[model samples]
Target chain A: MREPTVRTQKIKKDTTRTRLIFFGILALILIICSVFCEYLTPYDPYLQDLKNAKAPPSLSHLFGTDRYGRDMLSRVIVGSKASIFSTLLLVGLVTVLGTMAGVFGGWHGKRIDTVLMRISDMFLAFPGLVFAMAVAGVLGGGLQNAIIALMAISWPKYARIARSETLVQKEAPYLKAARLSGSGTLKIVFKHILPNIIGPILVTSMLDIGTMMMELAGLSFLGLGAKPPTAEWGSRMSDARSLLSSAPWVTLSPGVAIFISVMIFNLLGDTIRDYADPKSRGR
Target chain B: MDQPALKVSHLTKVFTRKGQPDFTAVDHVSFSIQAGECAGLIGESGSGKTTVVNMITRLLDPTGGSIVLNGEDITRMRGKELRKVYARMQMVFQTPAESFDPRCTLGDGIGESLRNNGRSRRETRDEVARLMEVCGLSADFASRYPHQVSGGECQRAAIARALAIKPRLLICDEATSSLDVTIQKEIIALLNKLRREKDSDLSILFICHDIALVQQFCNRVLVLYKGKIVEQGEVDAVIRNPQDPYTRRLIDSIL
Candidate 1:
């Protein structure tokens, strides 16, 4: 019985490893395609051909043409750059800024903690997309402003996670031992505290990727992000929304692209979360 | 003849909470440990034994009074100066596994102080190996995480980490309390061997509630009750002739 259980456990471990690698590679491929999307496109995503307008999926135009006769497949391929990279940049920005604020607040933890945490609470109190829309409306329509708007609301979540994690880690006996061993405040925070607290923070960030992507796309769909002719996934979907019944391929092309990318990223995040937590590794 | 390794005079800690009365944890507690001495602070739970230890180790700020280590008044020390004082004094906590950073290997934990003090990676590695061996842990155990090792092994690793800097005063705050009897004895023996090897250069403040264990290991013992040092003397003398009523009750309970 024990031998069979051990064998089954090994199999489970192998399955998790496979899922991790598979999703990891898929995510990498998406990133690489985005980076070199120009070369990968079969036709100019921006070039207009009124004669081939609203042409359905065919040998020449694989995902059909939009009302402007721009190749939908090429447009979706190019849109990956704006869609994926912006989400990544947003997640990176929030994680660093929030983690720093949180670590500082937790470590110092007096008037500073109260002030910073209250500010974070204020941010958390706002409905995320509505607040982002308001900020985007003020900042004016563009991908950067939309990102900046979303960033304003998203950072507080990371800050809260980092703060709570840091608070728990700050009182850990190992930290006390480190302090007693003559490690300075900076060394203790960077070397000991940060490393220990990072696991949860990383998992949180990984899980946020899909959400940020959707939010960014939602902003673009709402005309608050990636203005006309930029070939962003959300904007492409927005541009083809009118043709939904007649030439559904135009809208579905970018929608499908968004779906696949989001699924890959979300699955990757799930796999990473499972792998990072030791308790979940066996099962 | 020389200065005592650690000295505490009128050390006090009062926990102040908003809308609540200030509670005195350690009140006017005073004690000193001479060089090469193993001084035990014995008290029941809630007697402020750990509170006194915390104040001395600088883990908690003293509400009043002073702590002198190796004749230097460190009561007001902070930042660089406080860190400098940390080199001379170190603490081994109650739970050995919890006292080690789970993310770090045993070697890194043991070598942290040495690395902080400007020892190169190679030197720290060599020193960590030697310290682990001295603490009766094999060199291979250095690669293991805190959870990977048994409680006794982790305790040994904790001891090695404490001794890495060759601190003049080592504070063991119930260091062996979590271990089984046999393992506890082994740890005590290991500490004894280390003290013998370090000779008069080392001083130990062994905090424990087990009076029998304290009597066997410590040279001098301070009995604490309600944050006050109720009785104190050479271990043998105090055991034979109980002084304070609290001390008498403590002895009677054990006898």
Candidate 2:
């Protein structure tokens, strides 16, 4: 057993509270963008504007026009729906599957653990992007398919993390105390180990959301994602690449959109990591 | 004489690390405690004090031993049978804070043993309060989490939990070592009070590194040196007229 550290007084002004508020606002904005994408944009992103082709940023068009005369601002706004949707779906699937697999693998050692971990190891051998790309290639091109592809490779990291956390938690004195007091194996794993390790997994999933979104964008740019006319960020970037010299805003708009979204997710993930850390609390 | 509350015969425990030679943790230790007797096992750290306690409480499997409680041999018990045996013999750990679940409230922690033994929630609630009252805890502490309480309060909570099951034997593994001097005294006094008031046939196996503490609480003392018992006698005799060299050294250190 570890010795108890001296309890420090709680700070009057909490930096963590401020960070949570900031992240909450960013998350709210992304949610709003996702739910009201169509109503928020003035012009249809798919409607071509031949008359205003390759126009610079001005009062009439906030992000100007693209090579095909499409409204770049409208495209970026509407594109968030697909990006956020796919990333969230991918994260949700991976978290549930990974946590269960990890808990079972850690709790029941020997043959079951060996088999589960071997599968995890096999997934780990391949780079996540390459595995996702291969899965995407085999499954063919679509939003749902892309999410499935990402999850196939993404779940291994979470499983490995959960398994290790479970292994450590299983040996804690409280767990033994619980067992001695007659808590069944299911109750011990779910009630004690799950709650203790879920915080880290949640933070990891939040960070993974940003990565999944980027991956989705990359796939779409390669013509393997949400197809043209769907107004996805990657598809827009793909269309604008050829006309980079004449219409730099076309490329820059989607690039900035992806950058801001990823930054918000990363910041949110960092704050969650700090807040969930037991060492940071009661200091 | 009435049947002994706990009986141990030829208890031996050996621990072997991977690719390392086997080491004896407890070498042929044997002892017995009558109902309501307080027996102390005194040793320095790594002297197998806890190892003996663990084997007796069924936390660790003894390599070769037979433990008979009330004429029942529990040396080979497993699963539900082992758990049933545990219900009759509870343990209070050295670190009070670590003994109780951090996530659970004090009352819940105390009530857990009862719940595990198949007591209903309502019955557990009432019994937990009664146990706490006996252990000198307020009813309001039932809702307070482990972290909210002081070290002394947590230790009291642990004692209350141990008593909840109405066990025939209580194994305290350096139970009050983590407490302050004043708190330790208070806990000792509380234990003595409870023992007298209940008139319970509760045998206590008090394991500690401090011989002085054992002298204050225990009727008999067993001195252990390097996983082997060097001396066993009345506390006064063992402390005052020590025959073993290890016992003399321990007494000199305390004095």
Tell me the tens digit of each residue's lDDT in model 1 across A81-101: 999999999999989999999
The collision pairs in model 1 are none
Instruction: State each model's CA lDDT, in order.
Output: 0.92, 0.86
User: Which regions of candidate 1 are displaced past 4 Å?
Assistant: A1-14
Q: Which candidate is the best by DockQ?
A: 1
Q: What are the per-model DockQ values?
A: 0.78, 0.36
- Alpha-carbon TM-score of each model against the true structure: 0.96, 0.86
Per-residue CA lDDT of model 2 for A1-283, tens digit only, reads 9999999998666587689789979987997888899999979988987999899988878999987788889989999888876777778999999989998999887799999999989998998888888998899998888888888888888998999988988767677667667666777777678877888899899878778789988888877788777888887888789878878999999889988898888888878877878577545
Model 2 alpha-carbon miss at residue B238, Å: 4.1
After the best TM-score superposition of candidate 2, give how far the Cα of residue B121 lies from its true spot, in angstroms.
Answer: 4.3
Candidate 2, CAPRI quality class derived from DockQ: acceptable
Interface RMSD (one decimal) of model 2? 1.7
Clash totals in order = 0, 0
**lDDT (10s digit) by residue, model 1, range B1-255:** 588888899999999999999999888988889999999999999999888888888888899999999889999888888888888898899999999998899999999999989999999999999999899888999899998999999999999999999899999999999999999999999999999999888899999999999999999999999989989999999999998998889889988
